[model samples]
Target chain A: MSGGTTTRVDARGGSLFAGSASVRALVYVALAALLFGFGAIAPTHLASEFVLRIGAGGLLLGMLALSVAFLMSQAGLVVLGAASVYGGVGYLFAIAMSKWDLSPTAALLFAFCTVIAYAAVLGALIVRTNPLAFMMLTLAAGEMISHSVMLEGLRDYTSGADGLVVTFKGAVFGMTAADFANATQFWPIAWSAAWILGFAAFAVRRSRFGAILRAIQENEERMRFSGFGTYLPRLAAFVFVNAIADVCGLLHVLNSGFVSPESLGLSVSTNALVAALVGGVANSTGPIAGGVLFAFAQDQFGAHGFTQLLTGLAVVVFIVLLPRGVIGGLIEGARRRSVLSSKRRRTA
Target chain B: MRAHGVIALLIANSLALASLLIMLSSGLALIYGLRDVINFGHGALYMLGAYLGYSIALIGGFWTALVVSPLLLALLGIAFEYLVLRPLRGRSHIEVALVTLGLGIILGQALIFVYGGEARGVDAPPALAGSVRMFGLSYPLYRIFLIAMGLGSCTALALWLRFSTSGLYVRAVSQDPSVARMMGVNADRLSLLVTSLSAAFAGVAGVLAGPYLSVDPGMDVTMIVNCLIIVVIGGTGSIAGAIIAALLFGFVQVAGSVFLPDLAALAPYVLLFVVLLIAPRGIGRGRAPA
Candidate 1:
């Protein structure tokens, strides 16, 4: 009776890895190829500088989205403040580089450490709360960061609302000569970082720690009953994902050579959420797909009439019609078709 | 710093703060507690109410606008529920919240496009324009009237929620939609009604706030962030919780501004952090059912 009940619950709960292996593999490869192609050609695109900008922008947004995706898709934590980590790291880098006159390498290191500390502290505090409260707390934390940046006394260090601008150090990996010669030298670094992070995420998703996180996502109480330290894992996931966002923040400051309040604003946070949702929260490559599509749509419709109207309409439509997200919806449809076809053959 | 003057200032400020917080936070709490939606667009609705009131008052007097704007906003809320929110039900609450955030951005920018982004304030009606002598100090009579209106509305809302069958149905559905449905309550219809009513309350607050606060496109961001903090500090599903939290926030804000003006802006967040530390479930005993 116990075994049967477990199977019944498992069936009703739905497995994350329900789709066929071949389709999943194809989806992953297609995503990898698209990222490579986009990164390669973006800097050269002349119809507008938008493609290249968004390619780089998507990387920054993707990093943040990935952080939230980890919490939402893996650990079942809905973090509304992932953008705070992104913005906080960027703020740290800007303050270090511009205000303190630190070297780029030193600034990057300081920023990463600060974000990790912030995430760990906040994660430990809010991890035990319900999802609703957790979401609100993260939002409050994000607002605090934004407001603190706006405070007048911090103007000397933070530049107040005027923001901070820092000069780039040209190159860090012995690619100075090549970077100066070619305009797209930074593309390789950004693209390589994307691939490495993506691979790391995939591996993590397949690991024992990842399995524990997934189990927690599926049923936190059950995992707790099984003697797992739920709070520690959730906190670890929060810090790890936020650390990834911090890396993106470092890259953003490096690429743009400037940091502004907009980098950490609510819009940046919302865009990351939108991108993750558009990509498919459940799938490993969903954020990549969502990031690309959001960037593309942002570029395409932004130049025309009303950008907010277009984007808002798209979000509303997607939420209503494509709740599983673009990639997830496609995967689901294909799976259903395959199942129906196989059943027909058996009946015949 | 004269004794009577200080007392008057304190009374006026406290009253003003109480009125504003109660008006804003009540709508937020009702929407979240009843509908299970954070309603990120609550501020947009508030802003829309102000603008609509401005236009209507310009043509049809202040009292008329005060009455009509909320009714119109209620219709808009009904339309919003039927159009945007109803379909998105049963999905991730985060997505629903994001969609509303998107709607807010769109509505904000749209308002800017339609009515230039300049800040506007309504002129108080001739009858309530002058000051009333209070505790040997002059205080704006219009503000006192606003306080009365706000408190009256809050009392009416509380009584309705406690006494009426529809209100009981809203409470029941909010507690457990499936159980409420089994108990013969139409959960979807209750959600729609509560959502519209909550938005209508937001509209009333906006109209009351228009004379004292400037209305502009940028106001939505500030307003929404403040309301969200208010709701978070208050428990999500309790009107009494909202009242207590709002009063505390109002006092902290007013007192902080008077004493520590520079840190005054940070007071709400400090309060929020403290509340999170003390009661992660919010201040009141209202617990949203899982």
Candidate 2:
């Protein structure tokens, strides 16, 4: 339990690199290389298109999962309403771009600003409440927003649950103009965004704010006593992390070619939570792995409803048996044995 | 306009709402107050009860299901306690909450797989099938029967908890399980009993509800959300609180829909938010069965 001993053991067992920034940067490079390699070698046929579509979808879900995992693992915030933030911002982006003829860049900027506004206002109100209260409030907020959108009055804006489709012919930094013309064309942008976000999250976890958040999670009262503004750090983290979720939503709409009320539904929120928990909320990579697994299972079991049942079972099993999540549990176990052997050596 | 007709409709609706609310909130209140575990699976249990009733009514008779379904569900509740909740006894309440949430999802999806995700219904028995005239207005006799059954069950439960030795132990365990155990009361047994009783109540509610509402996979989500709102507003763990909260919510829901159908869905949350702002602990906090 000594901090030094734990750190030494973690270092020795490769736990440091297991979810570390450098490792994730390497993962990003590897994924991009693999995708490019596959695109290069695959026969120009329908099968490659299918593979690319699924891969892109997996990457989008992974990005969403990564945002949630960062908040849950790094900050100990179980945000059941994370998907609403994602879907809400996406909806806003689509409406702004398609209905009002706002430029895609303006829409994306508006969506991010809206998410920050939402997080600050709602986070400040519910941040002091207990976890259950916060969760219920978030659920209520999500329901209210969805219902509002679905109402006849807002139908013109939200399309009243029928959903809205937007055409994106914009370029980011002129990196191949209008590349999102098709799913295959859109893959590079989505993957690059995921890589950049994942890298930034990894960097954040190493920063002073991350340390303070960890301290607050461990002993908030003590940290408050030491003159730190606990609430502000948590609110900032909430805003920051949810902004990333909004970006995922933006990419999701751009890649999927449409958005629907189902995206903001309770099931979607529950799915995000499940993915984050199953993948190991203790690290960013866990969600990436978890997201891909979840999306694949979803497609495979879509016909029979087996995927939902399996996901629920996995969540229960992971929580009950693997309390620290898959990766965290393995790393912790290795660290523990290493500490034990080192102690035995010192005793001898 | 006929005053008597208006009065009759109001009475009938009030009675129906009260009956439904009591049935839904009792078990929720018990598990929450006693075990400090919010059984998110309560809704699934409710759905199970309805499905059980539907099948029994279809095969044997409606009355047979009215009797058999609750008993079966009570046993299921006991099994749930021993299997899932017991093992996770000392974990954080939130962890238990999440696990039960997972269990709810599994149970709900499994029910869908078994029942084919279609809506099912049960017919009221012959005696309770038709409407009865009261104060110059006709009201469904089945609704009246439901009201009577709900009231009778509440009375029986209240009496048992007040007069029985085991009732005292349940109350003690709810207040502080460790102290109750120190005093030689079997906390685990009492927990199982309460959980079973709660599930049984939900089953009875399901049987009554099946005729009024469509029995479908979606029912679990709707019932759980409504019941959680009631339990949270009325007070967590207090049977009296549950009854009061449920009645209040039932009236608001029914009346709100009658007045403004469009805004009806938002009524409960609006009420919940107002109450939370004024009294976050709910209306009957300190009055929980402790």
Candidate 3:
């Protein structure tokens, strides 16, 4: 009788995530390749440097959103503090280079690993809670990181909100700091990173581990009863998404050659979330597209000094009207049209 | 100053901060209990109240602002219930929360546009502005009034929840919505009441915060994050737990500022993590997780 009741409860437990991620992996790869190709070549062809720079920023934001969307889709958890890992990685890199006099390459490696560890430690604690609590904790944790960076004690190291300008002492991944900072040069790099991160997210979503994650998210108790360790999968997913955010953050700092408290602010994380919402959370391309779209919208609104106002409006509109996000909505529309045409042909 | 004097001041300060926090977090907890939705815009509402209070106080006095802000917010609370909350009732809680967050951003931006991002100061009425001596230590009277208001509200909240039919319904819905619905409890009506009451409390907290914390565009975000941390630490829907957590948060924040000075801003977060480490489910006697 108890077993029967448990299964029944499990059936209705994941109503929030009943329909998602049905597309095959091959499709994801093909779409990613197409996007990467366009992103890589389009910047070179376009004459406007301003647009390319904005596009690069969008790709970076998209990369961050990809991480956010993955966790949201797979784990039924929203991360409100992704900016910490993203911005924190940059701060560590700059600090390592400046304070410890480490080579840029070494600092890059050190910062990446450290942020991964930070994510692991943070994820271990936060993933134990329910989804809402998880969301709340992420936001708090993000704020904690932001505050620490501005600590008066760390003023010499972090510069106390004046921000740290990082000049690479040695070649990082065989590219000079100047190369990374150039708008035209940075565009392809950001585009490539977005594709790599997008594929990483896709691979995780397709793997057997991904299946377990979805199962756990859908009905954690059922998965646990069936002998799966639900905790580790979630913790792993948390780290995995944050690692994606970390990579984006590193790339962001690399391109900008600067890191500030603003990078780690709640607004940064919210922007990524808004991008995820605008683009759709189910697949990689959606978030990337959403990021690009948000970047452009921000640029437009920035002119009017209404960036945040539009951002807030966008969040409401997208969540209410475009629940699946722009890419998701567009895909759905195309699929519906195809189905309608097929039906007409069949009737004829 | 003597060690005892320092201790006394610490306690007084914590009580003042905790009073404001309790006023904010309790409203957040109550609404969460009733609706299973965290109003991410609670901070923006608080900001709105502070701004409104500033304007109203300029025309009348601090007393008038305190009284009028909550009444106006109660009306907005009703509108929020019928409009935002009701329309989004069928949506997922996360989605609804996101919408509230978005609305919060919009509202915050609107206030910033009007107020132009400068911090606004509201003077305490002449009666509460002066310091009073107690036990050989002088303390600000406004904070004393704040503590009194805090204690008064707590007593009122407790009494209402203990004796009233609506309050009981709220507790019932919060603890077990399905069971309460099966019993034919009108959750919608209860939610409406909770929403308005919570908004009113946020208004009160905002007005109180003006003389204490200063009114600014950024206050909404900071207060919301603090309240969110408190709510999470207290266990999402646990009202009693929220109050206790607010007290703890208040003490930690105050003590950190007084003692550490440098790492003061991060004190509440440290307190939060320690509590979460010890009790993953939170420091609350609330319902089991879904």
* Number of clashing pairs per prediction, in order: 0, 0, 0
Candidate 3's DockQ is 0.69
User: Which consecutive 10 residues in model 1 chain A have the weakest lDDT in total?
Assistant: A174-183
lDDT of 3 by residue, A115-204 (tens): 999999888888998887888889899999999999999899999889999788658888899999888888888888887888789889
Which of the predicted structures, 1 or 2, would earn the higher TM-score when compared with the native?
A: 1
Computed on C-alphas against the true complex, the DockQ of each candidate is: 0.41, 0.35, 0.69
**lDDT tens string, model 1, A1-348?**
774455544443454546676876887789878967875665565434445567667766776677777678887666666667777787887788777888767877888998899888888777777666677678778877888888776778888888787564655455442352343655556666776677777788889999999998778889989999888988888888887788777777667766677777776777777777787777657776677678777778778646566655666666767877888888988867755655454456
Candidate 1 colliding pairs:
none
Every prediction: chain A TM-score: 0.82, 0.82, 0.90
Give all candidates' CA lDDT scores: 0.75, 0.76, 0.90
Best by TM-score: 3
Those runs of model 3 whose alpha carbons end farther than 4 Å from true positions after fitting are: A1-35
Question: Could you give candidate 1's fraction of true interface contacts?
Answer: 0.35
* Candidate that beats the other on lDDT, 2 or 3, i.e. the better one: 3
Name the weakest run of 10 consecutive residues (lDDT summed) in model 1 chain B: B281-290
What clash pairs does model 3 have?
A: none
lDDT of 3 by residue, B1-290 (tens): 99999999999999999998999999999988877788899999999999999999999988999999999999999999999899998887888888999999999999999989789888998999999999999999999999999989988999999899988888888889999999999999998898999999999999998898899989998999999999988988899999999999999999999999999999999988888899987799766544
> What DockQ results for candidate 1?
0.41
Question: Model 3: share of native contacts present?
Answer: 0.81
* Candidate with the greatest DockQ versus the true structure: 3
Candidate 2 local lDDT, A46-161, one digit each (tens): 44666667666767777777877787766666676676887888788888887888877887788878878987877776566555555556666676666666776577888886
